[model samples]
Target: MTSLPEDPPSAISEGDRDTAVQRLQEAYSQGHISHEELDERLHQVLTARTRGELVAALASLPEENAGTTSTIAAAAGRIKRRGAWRVPRILKVESAYGRVRLDLSRAVIEHPVVDIELQLGTGRATITVPRDATVEFEDLRTGWKDTRYKPRARSRPGGPTIRICGTMGYGRLKIRHAWR
Candidate 1:
């Protein structure tokens, strides 16, 4: 008598692959791996067919840190963040009468999702996110002008999701994806 073969392992999804890639990028940024290593691992993650392969690609990486919330407030001045800055998992921005700009094109984002809350009064705010990121601002309330945002034609799978909320009083909010 012959026995049936064991069931094949489940295949990995695009989301799974994207998550592995993100973890690898974080590890690379934190100096856990070199450029060549990151390239190799990324290739492995992208080409992985099964969960085991994906897990193997992420071996030896440090666990993610607990998410923390940060607040940035300006009573009557300009607030800007650019260059190679680290983005927290949760951020709150409050401006009474100042312009605020957050450029996240080259920022180091280690989390899968980021939450940004804004409270502005009589000031404008401009936020630039990563090219591959997904932005959501449905919960934002504006008193003067509607929020300005143009989503990517086709957002990549497994990219970070940025959630924006809060209130804008007598001001405008502009959100755009980074070009570079």
Candidate 2:
């Protein structure tokens, strides 16, 4: 049998291609590659017309990062729990495509002025307001038929005042903290 040169043929060996796929899979499972990145890379590899291109793709493994914790709190003691005093007089909140809940069951007896902003892609929101506080609704934009306001039969004075700005796509929003 004749011995081949150190350099393999232009065609990629089955073992080399398999090893590349394995390395890519391991990188993804170990969280080294994001789903979008992995998909793009895999697409590039599988679509390579020549063996050299495939080999070049296989050699492009990204560097590993240990990640930083200066901005991340890993322990329970590092978390900040605000007392009643820190509660905002006017709670301004914003979100997209999801409902947000604000629980005031443990709130102090203080008049709160709340401002809410939501850019919902497709969802609903239900807000529970204490009785007696006045509410004002401002509709920025909505894809739904109309915005519905469901209020409690009773009202409580000196409660929270709610101001809402929202854009809903086939969704509903309820602001209950308003006093009528």
**Which candidate has the highest lDDT of all?**
1
lDDT (Cα atoms) of all candidates against the true structure: 0.83, 0.50
Best by TM-score: 1
Evaluated against the true structure, the overall lDDT of model 1 is: 0.83
Worst 10 residues of 2 by lDDT: 68-77
TM-score for model 2?
Answer: 0.40
- Model 1: per-residue Cα lDDT over 39-108, one tens digit each: 9999899889865677778778876664578899889999999987768888999999999999987676
TM-score for candidate 1, residues paired by index: 0.68
Q: If scored against the real structure, what TM-score would every candidate get? A: 0.68, 0.40
Clashes of each: 0, 7
Model 2 alpha-carbon miss at residue 106, Å = 4.1
